[model samples]
Target chain A: MTRPDRAAIIGIGYSDISRNSGTGPGTLIARAARAAILDSGVAKEDIDGVVGVYGSDSPTVWPGYVVDSLGLPNVTWWDTAQPPSIVGLSSAAQAVLAGNCEYAVFYHGKYRWGSTSIASKGDPLRESPAHEMDPTFSNPLVSHAGSLNWAARVMRHHMDRHGSTREDFGKIAINNRTHALTNPRALFRTPIKMGDYLAAPMIDEPMSLLDMDAPVDGAMAVVVTSLERALDGPHTPVVIEAFGSGLPIGSEGNLWPEADGLAARRAVASLFGRTDYSPTDMDLAYPYDGFTILTMLWLEALFTEEGGGPELLRDAWSEDEQVLKLFGRMPMCTSGGNLSEGRATQGFGSVLEAVQQLRGTAGDRQIGGSLNTAVITNGMAATNRSTILSVS
Target chain B: MAHTRRNYDTQPYWEGCDQRELRIARCADCHTWIHFPRGVCPNCWSDDVRHEAVAGDGQVVTFSRPRVPDGAPPMVTALVALDAADGVRVLGRLEGAEPDAIRVGMPVSLDWHEEDGQLVPQFVPSGGAPA
Candidate 1:
């Protein structure tokens, strides 16, 4: 069968990210959806589909709720999926391509107290459910199965096997902070130096406070439609060149760094297979910095072979500018990423930033040369989702 | 602090811990040892899996020293790759070594400790430090 027309992201919108929004997730979702609809200049009546991501951590913001909130009367397709909005983006793109809907809105919202935010402990209204132990890995003597603990182990493992140092991880933190300085939407904009990263309190050994993403309450949404139809829209449409997801076979419960990298590698390889653009052809890249170590693994998966990420990172750092320019030209996470962007989980923040850069609207963080192609990767280990976007 | 919760698939492993044994699931058909036990064998999809005790010899793949909030001593946790279980790793607290002294790939042997009247598996340095 001949391939269908590619879908394109026509507009992007997001609410301000903060430690506390003093609003429920449903309100945040509606605000973002309205902003995205207004930004796209697409009439509310023209929208035919809606897609949103909801997780156990965030209050449910189903697509039906979005349609009702936005008063989209002609909606024929709507569905809610899991978090990391890429999954929803992919679904919207597919629906548009198949002619199921002419225009679809994809959204994801995060609540600070819904996650493991320290600030949540103080608010009685934000009290989350009791933590239940994972029966498979839990022991009565140790409580160390959480994601932070897993990242700590992965960082140590990467250092042990690849001869990378804490400074290498520090470079990622500094690079993000430097970019975040220009991002008005970023939560932590103050620049951090290598010393600050190294001196930061260690939450879990090897993974310092700066190594993790800041949890915040916010929401992001994007309007996706067929590339052909998007050409008539107001903004420059960023085409979804290709999208793919992958998981390593027989990798159930395998938290090893090697296995984690393999999953990303598989996803990226599948992604590249569907597109003409190789890793070197991209003008910018966002490899998901939910943790510093994840960015390291993603860099390796995208550019080099295994055990090569640290060296690539080391070379990407520019001491003269105190910023990271991959291979001395291409920039990563110009929107500050999750590290500084207040953890807009599921790669939504990256996608939004990529769209901005491709449209030459990233303000001071924009790349100098002609920016055409970009890659956005989300999730890790078991659920790896990737997409290649371009303004060709 | 009590952490282990018994489920139908993992009850046998907890029972083995009570007997001072480290048990993992082994497929009756493919003989593939599985950690984080599920009812069926992931490798072969065989429901004829049995919980069996192993020698509990392993090496630390990696470790972390997480800070405690209540001014308690830092906890050192390690992920161990079991010797007999192919491609199986387990998380446990590491004892008998200081945080500064701990290193990746250090030889460790499993030991059981009592937590709230329940036996929980842990690891300690064995065969001296790596040269």
Candidate 2:
């Protein structure tokens, strides 16, 4: 109950598919759990504790059902975390740190996104016979959250508040797409120019279609246990230096923290609080890039980079500016991320990339460095709910 | 592929859909109201929660439009962060909405939409206090 061996992530497991593998939720989660257990080098018998975050599926993928299916002793902890799974990971880490169990596993699973299970109370997103049956449904309508027109509200606020431009948004996508080539996992691997990004499709007013995470489906899982046990048990455990989740827990003045409320920098600062290492001490960080503009905001959030990170990204892709390389310096998501590579769920892909980098098994996309730590981030939809993962 | 009858999690929400009322949980303890009923008050994690009808009276807490996959977008939508118990918010497509009329703090209320045995929460401008 007093901080069990200082949890470290031992084994990372993944389902085979990076793109919508055409799998169902049950199969996807089960497969990822199986792979993680096997990769950890510990027999399933050694596992006494488990924490999980299921999505949207209520009543069906309930923890009791998962516990019964996985054949684990009566579950001590279970939570169906939404799109952003790191929030649940923080909870799981607490349980493990609390000594509820010697070894624990945290998992997030999902099927391809297109098959999203909708409530019958008329799926708000139900397709008309034309869109579904006719292979083309006219975009019925569009609107925004607290921001009025999505990030554009923020963009408006940001631009009106500062003096940025539509070009700033386009640059993030261009740079992210260019970075995709190095990542085998990104969905939009094709390189693009700033002009192409500008000329490309627009989803809502001011928000470009490419500004969104290409919806697909996939699952990702990570194993957590005491450092000693994790290191001694099997695969080299990735040390979990620190992590944090914050819900406007207090700030009531504003409603949605769309871009900044998550306080990711604060989360990362807290994670590294006890450690003497600075942001410069880590290898790379991956902030959730559900939209290109979101990632641009993350540049300042991480504190290790400049706000113009997205612009750096665009220039690196275009022959116009210095390549935004993070070699021995700032290694971001070498894995094609939700933006370019695979866009199913949020935390899974980012978590996998961190594990891959830490394990030195990143293969082709390996960044050159001591590579001891990497930060992965996830944000909930248009909401500012975000969590940070510092994997070492 | 036609999916089967989907189970509605919030019975009151669906019930409200039947009567065209936007229903919410009033934190009996805190006098705060919220949507997506949480058993415990998000403010204090206290479970002293009960139901209260939100005139859908709220502000646009957040809004967005997914115009991808083209044509089949839902009605103009925004998450109305309401003035209910503890000031909880609900996500629904705005009703009787003029594109420019939808303001971030514009006061609004509920309009219900029921289809295929399903009830959904839609919002309309909170009209003059119900006489």
Measured by lDDT, the strongest candidate is: 1
DockQ of the candidate models in sequence? 0.18, 0.18
Q: Candidate 1 — which residues are off by over 4 angstroms?
A: A1-148, A250-255, B1-3, B127-131
Q: Candidate 2: how large is its RMSD?
A: 12.3
Q: Alpha-carbon error at B130 in model 1, in Å? A: 12
C-alpha TM-score for every candidate? 0.74, 0.58
- Tell me the lDDT of model 2 at A105: 73
Worst 10 residues of 2 chain A by lDDT: A134-143
Interface RMSD (Å) of candidate 1: 12.9
Q: What is the lDDT of residue A341 in candidate 2?
A: 60
lDDT of 1 at B23: 84
lDDT of model 1 at position B46 = 51
lDDT for each residue of candidate 1 in B26-112, tens digit (9 for 90 to 100): 889989785655444544445476888888788888887888778776678788888878777777888777678888888889887
